[model samples]
Target: MFGIRPSQKVLLLWSTPVDAEELQAMVGELKSVVGAEGKVAVENVEMLADSSHAGSHFDLILAGVLPPFQFENSLNVLGEALRILKPGGSLIVRTTDSATTQSTLKLTGFTSVSQPEDASLTDEQKRDIISPVSEITCLKPNFEVGSSMKLSFAKAPAKPSANTWNINLTDDDVDLEDPDDLLTEEDLIRPDPTTLKVCGTTGKRKACKNCSCGLKEELDAEDEKRVEENKKNFKSSCGNCYLGDAFRCASCPYMGMPAFKPGEKVKLAESTLQDTS
Candidate 1:
């Protein structure tokens, strides 16, 4: 309000009903602060009706369309509102997702979202969500000191691999249409798929969190309930490597780190470097 130019009017479009008296007082306060006569208009809004009427060239459109618990257009709805805003103007939408900003830009057809992600957020709701800006840039204990340090990750990182990297066309390497042997996770020490098993709800519960094993899934079958119940103690690995998190791909960074084994962390200091002479 203090910074309002003599020429411009502030338009308030909100989904909730505003207190007219308070709004009038706020406008009055703004006018008094600015020492200029200006206009302020307030409108109540529902998203699906008259979405286009909200703004034509709004310098700023602050939006807060609560997301549906079921999949809905909350992200894209806000983005559409953002599209009507003037360049260098803003369409601020408060949301809980870490990817909200990127989603906002992408949905509105922007190539990139700004860094220090929290800067784009509204100051009021900023406290509640993951401020990727601050959290991503916070001081690190092992960082180089007495100098500025920066990190930029490529959108695509190279797929890490095991065994030898060969450009050569050998029999071992694929020579397509010639003698060749395809290297598989089988060549690596892949755990046996047969050794791994999963239990459905009909199966004796192995605690929840098992993926649907399409092979043995027969929860709908009336005759198989007993069989499934008996199989609940089942164990399984991601069939070979291409399907699930498995031991073979434990070394593959794409597969990610293995689950921490019990007691391994407690004994870490003793397991590492020995007291050498």
Candidate 2:
């Protein structure tokens, strides 16, 4: 039995009109086991074989008995299932013969490959063999004279967590000094504005601030004077910047930002009027 959990996503792969009802019933049974939080998706094998759900993180992949002819290449279907499955996910494959299925699963990088024992088979499975092709007549590799049909299960190994790291430390590796004390007094000191270069020959300018290159106080008077001049000549364009003529500033509230004609639950912030570039 599949150990399905609550809120887990399960994928059921089945052929159209072939054992669809049985697979659907299986999904419903799984859903009941997981209570109200379970979700099940039924898809055709061919549809999933070429899909690119690299990180779908499906908790379970229940491949209801598929005919070997349905899959042109079995590896493509298995590869797709493995690619979408999250680490530690479970995949159950129902095939005509367990021996071939076990071998294929092991060859495809599936861990803990196993088949149900004779005692584990349900009465219905023991009584009848339901598949597209007759299990007895099918040409299978390494087929024992009297091998029985069964289901196979394999686990995708769990991956290591990103935050987990293993490191060996010694007494010599210990550091008791404060990280702030690493900087010298001269390194902390600010530069004189008189020796700094300013972007004076610009059509659009950024507001200068106290930085390692210069003292902001020297540029404050000049910046204020420029701001006043800019306001007088300002047009209703993108962020009052000349770049509006060539490019649209979608983040600029004055020109391109969308607003509800009648105010909705929230209002646009005043800071959006400032140039984003």
Candidate 3:
């Protein structure tokens, strides 16, 4: 009843225990159909239900080989069968319960699940095998499990044309006013230096002791200029200013001043002016 060809691998699966002679006979028949080049494996349905076989191994799977073959765990058996069978492989199930078997086969992911009208068994063979045998055939899908392919009919979205954009603007929509016109009189006026704090410190113009804002340098320059102006106008009454401190009068204005050449200009060190006493 199996349309097994030569050189095609086949599996004969039986759930119920059968006579050793009958089992051998079934194996012999399957072997003849497959021939020497082909392979035929006989296994109990429980073995496949509990565990799994190598996927896509068998070309055809003949389930429920004996008559009155009813699977208690139909889903597991058929699912395992589908897993083991190669893509586009055929499965023939000889079942007494056609409705349940068909439903289980479809649920197990087998495609084209249907019952054959003619089982092609002779009257004598039917009598011997017991009557009312229904054969259900199904095929594993052509594509393997988890396999994918893009559809040829599916079209990609068309790209939008550059002409579709509305970039042309009317004169009324455009603003021709100069950017400078946006500023007010106050914005154009310069900010006061006193109001602007140096280095963003708490008080205005209050620079850090070790100043980095150039404010310290500017003040130092002004002090140096004042000192230079004072020195230019000074006329030493004692006339001992060019000599060292020891030669000058104790009340001398240049008392702490260092000795220098007669014509050389002397710049006093800042520490000399401090009133330590």
- lDDT for each candidate structure: 0.41, 0.56, 0.77
| Candidate structures ordered by lDDT, highest first | 3, 2, 1
Instruction: Give the winner by lDDT.
Output: 3
In model 3, the runs with Cα more than 4 Å from the true position are 116-118, 121-131, 161-165, 168-277
Supply candidate 1's per-residue lDDT for 5.
Answer: 54
Per-model clash counts, in order, read 6, 0, 0
Q: Mark the regions of model 2 whose C-alpha exceeds 4 Å error after superposition.
A: 51-56, 65-73, 119-126, 130-277
Model 3 pairs in collision: none
- Which sections of candidate 1 miss by over 4 Å? 1-6, 16-39, 45-55, 64-76, 110-112, 115-277
- Which tens-of-lDDT digit does each residue in 100-158 have in candidate 1? 44454555544324442333434543464442332111111222223364557536766
- Lowest-sum lDDT 10-residue window in model 3: 116-125
Which ten contiguous residues of candidate 2 have the minimum total lDDT? 132-141
Ranking by TM-score: 3, 2, 1
* C-alpha positional error of residue 153 in candidate 2 after TM-score superposition, expressed in Å: 33
TM values, all candidates: 0.29, 0.40, 0.55
For candidate 2, lDDT tens digit of each residue in 157-197?
Answer: 88988998978899799867997899999988999754455
